[model samples]
Target: MSEPVLELTGLTKTYKPGTPGAVQVLRGADLSIAPGQVVALVAPSGAGKSTLLHIAGLLDLADQGRVTICGQDMTGKSDRIRTAVRRRDVGFVYQFHHLLPEFSAAENILLPQLANGVGRSAAQARAMKLLDRVGIANRADHRPAALSGGEQQRVAFCRALANAPRLLLADEPTGNLDPDTSDQVFAAMMELVAGTGLSALIATHNLELAARMDRVLRLENGRLTEITGQQAGAGFLQSD
Candidate 1:
C-alpha cells in the first residue's frame, strides 16, 4: 500500500510553559491523511484548529510527539531541513486570501516557484495554467484591488497549487464569502485538488461542507475524533 501523506502521533503543543498563564493547546492529538483523501477538521473557536494546522504545516513546532510527512519522520530535524521540506511538500490556504495587493495575480502565484529556483518562464507558465484551472486566468494581470473577494480567493487557490504540493492545508478558506460564493470556491478547490490526487485537511465551521468530505474529525479537548455524518451535523449545533 502507498504510505500515508501525513501522520501525527501523540502531538502536543503548550503555550507559556511553566508560567502562570500557560495553556495547553494540543494534548496527544493524532491524525493521518492518506493520498487523495479530503478530511474536514471541525472545531469551535479557540479549540486550537489553527494551532494544529500551524504545527502540521511545519510553521510551528510541537512541544511533544511525532510528525511524519510522506513517509519521512520530522522529529529532531534541523529548522533548515524542516523549512525545506515544508516549502517543497506542503501547501497552505488561510481564512484571508493573503495575496499581495501590489502584485498582479499571476505574479503572486509565480513568486513561490521563483523562490524555489524554478526558471522564470517556467514558473509563469505554471502560474498561468493554475490560474486557468481555477477559472481566474482572465484576472491574471489584475492586482488584488481590482478583483472581487471571490476572484481574489480563486487567485489564492491558484497560488497555493504553484508548488504542486503533496499535502494541502486550509484554514477557514471560505469563511469570508457568502454561502453561494463559498460553495463555488469550495467546489473549485476540491475539484482541483482531487484532479491532482493530493491529500487535504480543511479546518472549517461549515457543517454542510464538512459532511461532504471523505471523513470528518472534530477537535475537542485538544484531541481529534472521527465523527459520523449524522454526528457532524449534531456537533455543529453545539458549535453555534
Candidate 2:
C-alpha cells in the first residue's frame, strides 16, 4: 500500500498552556487521509475541529503531536519550511468565502499560483480550467461582489485549489449558504476534488453532507474516532 497523503498522530493542543485556566482542546487526536479520499470531520461548536485543521494545514502548531503530509513529517519544522509545505502541499478553505473584493474570480485563483512561482500564462490557464470544472467559467471575469453566494463560494473553491495541493483542509466550507445552494456548491466542490484526485478533510455540521464522504470522524475532547451510523444519527440530532 502507498503512504497516506496526510496523517496526524497524538495531536494535543491547549489554548492557555501552563496557565491555571488552560483548556485542553485535543487529547492525542489522530487521523489520516489517503489519496482520493474525502473524510468528513463532525464535531460540535468549540470542539476544536478548526484547531485540528489549522494544525494539519500548518497554519498553526500542535502542542504535542506529529503532522505528516505526503509522507513527510512536518512537526517542529521552522516557520519557513512550514509555510513552504503549506503552499506546496496543503490547501485551506474556511466557512466564509474570504475572496478579494477588488480582484476578479480568475485573478483570485491566478494570484496564488503566481506567488508559488508559476508563470502568468500557465496560471491563467489553470485558473480557467478550475473555474470550468466548477461550472463557473463564465463568471471568472466577475469580482466576488458581483457573483451570487454559490458562485462566490465556487470561486473560492477554485482559489483554494489553484496550486494543486496534495491535501485539502476545509472548515464548514458550505456553512454560509442556504440549504439548496449549500448542497449545490458542496456537490460542485466534490466534483472538483474527484476530478483532481486529491485527499480532502472537510469539517461540516451537516450530517447529510458528512454522510457523502468516504468516512466520518468525531472530534470530542481532542480525541478523534470513526463514527458509525448510530453515532452519526445522534450527532445529527445534537447538532440540530
Candidate 3:
C-alpha cells in the first residue's frame, strides 16, 4: 500500500491544561489518510473535530503526539520547516468562504500561487484552469460579494487547490450553503479533488456526505471510531 499523505499518532490536546475547566479535545487519536483517499471525519460541535483538523493542518499544536505529512515528521519542528511543509503539501477549506471581498475570484486564487513564487502569467493560467475545473470559469472575474453562495464556495475551492497541494483538509466545505447548493458544490469539489489525485480529510455533520467518502471515522470522547455507512447518524457528533 502507498504511504499515507497525512498521519496522526498519539495526538493529545488539552486547553487550559491543569486548570479547573480544562477541556480535553484529543486523547491519543490516531489516523492515516492514504494517497488519493477521501476520508470523512464526523463529529459533533464540541467533540473536537475542529481541533483535530487544526492540528492535522498544522494550524495548531498538540500537547503530545506526532504529525507526519508526506513522510516528514513535522511535530516539534522549527516554525520555518512547519510553514514550508504546510505551504508545499496541504490545502485547507473551512465552513466560511473567507475570500477577499475586494479581489476577483481569479485573483484570490492567483495570489497564493504568486506568494509561492509562481510568476504572474503562470499563476493566472493556473487559476483559470482550476476555475474551469470547478465550473466557475464564468465567475472568475467576479468578486466574492457578487457571487452566489454556491459560486463563492466554488471559488474558495479553487483557491484552496491553487497551490496543487497533495493533501486537502476541509472543514465543512459545504456547511454554509443550502442543501441543494451544498450537494452540487460538493460534487464539483470532489471532481476537482479526484482530478488532481489529492488525499482529502473532510469533516462534515451530514451523514449522507460522510458515507460518500472512502471511509468514515467518528470522534467521541477524544478518540476516533470507524463507522459504516449504515451506522452514520445525525447524533454521531456527540462528545464523550
Show how many residue pairs clash in every candidate, following the order shown: 0, 2, 1
lDDT string for model 3 (1-240, tens) is 898899999999999999999999899999999999999998767889999999999999999999999999987798899899899899999999999999999999999999999999999999999999988899889999999999999999888999999999999999899999999999999999899999999999777787888999988889988887555555543323
What residue runs in model 2 are displaced by over 4 Å at the alpha carbon? 230-237
lDDT of 2 by residue, 1-240 (tens): 779999999999999889999999999999888899999998879999999999999988999999999999997789999999899999888899999999999999999999999999999999999999999999999999999999999998889999999998999999999999999999999999999999999999898999889899988778988987776666542443
Candidate order by lDDT, highest to lowest? Answer: 2, 3, 1
Q: Which stretches of candidate 3 lie over 4 Å from their true place?
A: 233-240
Q: Weakest 10 consecutive residues, lDDT, candidate 3? A: 231-240
Clashing pairs in 2: 26-222, 27-222
Compared with the true structure, what per-residue lDDT tens digits does model 1 show for residues 4-75?
999999999999999999989899999999899999998878989999999998999899999899999999
How far out, in Å, is residue 157 in model 1?
A: 1.2
The better-scoring model by lDDT among 1 and 2 is: 2
